[model samples]
Target chain A: MSDDELARKQRRRRNIAIGLGVAGFVLIVYLVTILRMQANLAAGP
Target chain B: MRHKPGMRQPVAISSMSAPDVAGPQDYFDLLKPRVMSLVVFTAAVGMVAAVADGARVPFGLALASLFAIAVGAGASGALNMWWDADIDSVMARTVGRPVPRGVVPRAEAAAFGGFLSALSVALLALSSNYVAAALLAFTIFFYLVIYSMWLKRSTPQNIVIGGAAGALPPVVAWAAVTGTAPVEAWILFAIIFLWTPPHFWALALYRDGDYARAGVPMMPNVAGRAATKRQIFAYSVVLAVAGLAPYFVGMAGPFYLAVAAALGGVFVYLAFKTLRSGDEDKASAKQLFAFSIIHLFAIFAAVLIEDLVALHV
Candidate 1:
């Protein structure tokens, strides 16, 4: 209803988006590590 | 406008000073998603072409590397926006960008760009190989430091030499997959590099006033429109030849060659039309500008499709 309220809402939404982005990055790193290990194992020692 | 008992006082919405709170979309806009999409597409085509050439790249790794490349490209876009915000604020085409519009601050853009550049390069190295990482770093540096900060203001030939940054995504992806950038990869790069001048000069022809106002030395602002048209036609001739090089080098099949040749022919024809158009007529330049986007996209898409069919079907 007001400028202050709108600003707060935007900030809250931005924080949530950032949280999700960080979580996504962590998931990607985990998946990449697993995939790389599998490839290395398939290639043999 | 009078306040009654138990009623709130009227507040003028226009006079209300809105706080500077940027949403995630503003930050995403800083990344220049359009350019990121182009980078991802061309890089994927490069990876697929390499795969077709017998370079064994796992699908997941390819996807991860592509993500890194996209982020790296976005980082460059952010940094460019950060540096060019002043000029961008005056240009009609760029005035709506995040930094220029005040949705995002320039310093924040620079920091965000710097952080993403490092993270993307590291991710590429970790997920793929060092060569890809190095190429991504170089691309970011070239776009930010060389093109945006220096050449962009100093020379009319800015986009000509600066096109290398835009052209390197495919080469980087090829190196990511094969650990070496072969001639085929450079042919892809050459196609894009040659396409840049004609593509941008056409836009400059119509937007010379915007460029002149921003004090940027776009071809039409530095050289007259006639000379810019001549250069566009000249570059279009070479681009047509470069577009067909993938076939001669055996990187693509007959279907690709046919599509490329047809698209290249039309590209040159449009450039010729633009060249012959009267000085005050921007219609031809506008048509050429619009077609150049399709020309580049279709050529790459044709190569990608042919390679994909060869690999799967």
Candidate 2:
């Protein structure tokens, strides 16, 4: 691959990685909150 | 073409050097953390105020909810900055902001804000309820679309209307806690909403030239300073009454009433002083603007403390 093509591929990969990281972080937060709230509700007052 | 023996070959170099990678702090700055802190504080107060006597959530969950509130508020700020970056660049007071200073590109700001807006609201729903989640979404929309995109450049009533979006955080928190909004929740909303005009108009009074240059229809720029001051005085009277309403309605105690009365008087007095002054009294305008911030903080602090004490006793 040419240097330009390699650079473009690297940039695209970096963006996708960043996007996935953010998505994963948000997913974990939501899961933790859901589990915690469910446990609280199950504890019954 | 043959180069001379001493001449070096010209190398192909990329014209675009590396763009500065935004650090965590830059993203945080895009959130306008200062304003977010105040919103979070008020939202916490709203939560505390909404709780029935002796009712408590799991401490960890409560903390998570507060974090969500802060993130939602920050999302609104980021969206506001993204939309206002054009005007922000022109205004002297806002020229050094991340978006305007090129620390965060406008598209990046919008995308980050959009992502946070969804993430914060969705998390809030998981932690709280759909009512609160929906309110958060509406607040974001009001701020970004109604206020920033339309009313801001078009009308002198921009801040007056835009204030609703800023004021909704506390209401959203209250709804999150109670699962249903009460009249008291809206009373908190009213205090912030009513407080907005005088607070922002005081700023407009001093920053008239900046507003004029930026072509933003701030009250003092659209109307004369005299008219703006009259409106400020009018709003100050209404705000003082609204600020003290929680105590009158039995949400706060006598001590809060006294504190509110005293500070409210000082607030009105400052606005009055600014109004009565000649055209050149930027100091008086500045004083009113400074005191207005303190007035809100003091009133809300009293409410939070009074409610917490009430809960214990």
Candidate 3:
């Protein structure tokens, strides 16, 4: 591959990593909230 | 005829790229999750204790208040990391933190911390009582302003006075249920207050070089090791006395008293060994630090268990 293509691929990989990280964090928060609510329901009167 | 030649190089070494910068997880690590867990657990115990005492706190409100306290504690951790990132980078124990590691920018950390602080306090006020909310705000202020900004760098007596931030969680939990600070709540506060110095100083004793390298004025760093050891012994004695106060005040029962007494004895023995050990072996400090966590957890756990037993029997 040309040097220009290599640079572009690297940039793409970086962006993909950043996107995945942001998505994962949001998913974790959503899951935690859901689990907490479930536990609260289980312990309810 | 002889000719002389010189070599020329690029002014900037562009090939040597900066080490891969840390990402979001690094910043999260700086918030001291282990410490935050203990704070959250103790705060929950405080809330449970209040409920067990017939304060009539709803479970939902109790949970919300606990969440708010946890967020506030996280905010304190983030803010401390933001401010101390410079020193943190120099300390072995703290060098891997997000802010220091460049995973998260300092400005972002500060903004995130401030946002959490405001959100937590506002939510607590809405979900719980204003007294609880106010105490939460004060706790954040104490940790950030009093402890982190001023006391940490200014004096060897820093943690001694600043331990109040950690000590207030139970009181905040109590106020959430009762809508007022009671004498019993303050007694619980005193137990944690006296417990903080000795527990933290033990860690400081073991990590004295880290504080010295970072230029932070920890007790062992500012005062000599001997003085720090002596203070640890003194604080342990005070903590043991304070731990028994809950029973006398009728807030806890025989179970809690027995657990507190046994744990306090061990704590004092460890502190005494830490003081007398001349081998420079930090085993006592390490043992005391680790057990101190268990000690606090057990004391609060005993409180909850005893209350449950009383209600049933």
Question: lDDT winner among the candidates?
Answer: 1
Candidate 3: segments with Cα more than 4 A from true spot = A1-45, B1-27, B279-281
Interface RMSD, candidates in the order listed = 1.1, 5.1, 7.8
Residues B1-313, candidate 3: write the lDDT tens digits: 1111321211111121333343344545655788789888888778777877887755656777787788888888998888877777777787767676665678978987898788789767766768899999999999999998888877888888999999999898889778988888888889899998988899998998887766667888778889989999999998988889889989898888899999999999999999998658388899999999989999888887887777677
Q: For candidate 1, what is the DockQ-based docking class?
A: medium
How far in Å is the alpha carbon of B97 misplaced in model 2? 1.1
TM-scores vs. true structure, each candidate: 0.94, 0.86, 0.82
Model 2: per-residue lDDT, tens digit, B1-313? 2222432332222233334344455677878898899999999898898774333565556666778878888888888888777677767788767787775778899898999899888878877778988998999899889998888878899999999998998889887776777878888899999999999988988888887767778888778899999999999989988988997777888888998899889988988898889777689989999998999999999999888887778
Considering just chain B, what TM-score does every model have? Answer: 0.94, 0.92, 0.91
- TM-score for candidate 1, residues paired by index: 0.94
Residue clash pairs of candidate 2: none
What is the C-alpha local distance difference test score of candidate 2?
0.81
The window of 10 residues in a row where model 1 chain A has the poorest summed lDDT is A21-30
- Candidate 1, which segments miss by more than 4 Å at Cα? B1-18
* TM, chain A, every candidate: 0.94, 0.88, 0.80
Error of model 3, residue B191, in angstroms: 1.1
Q: Which has the better TM-score: candidate 2, or candidate 3?
A: 2
lDDT of 1 at B162: 98
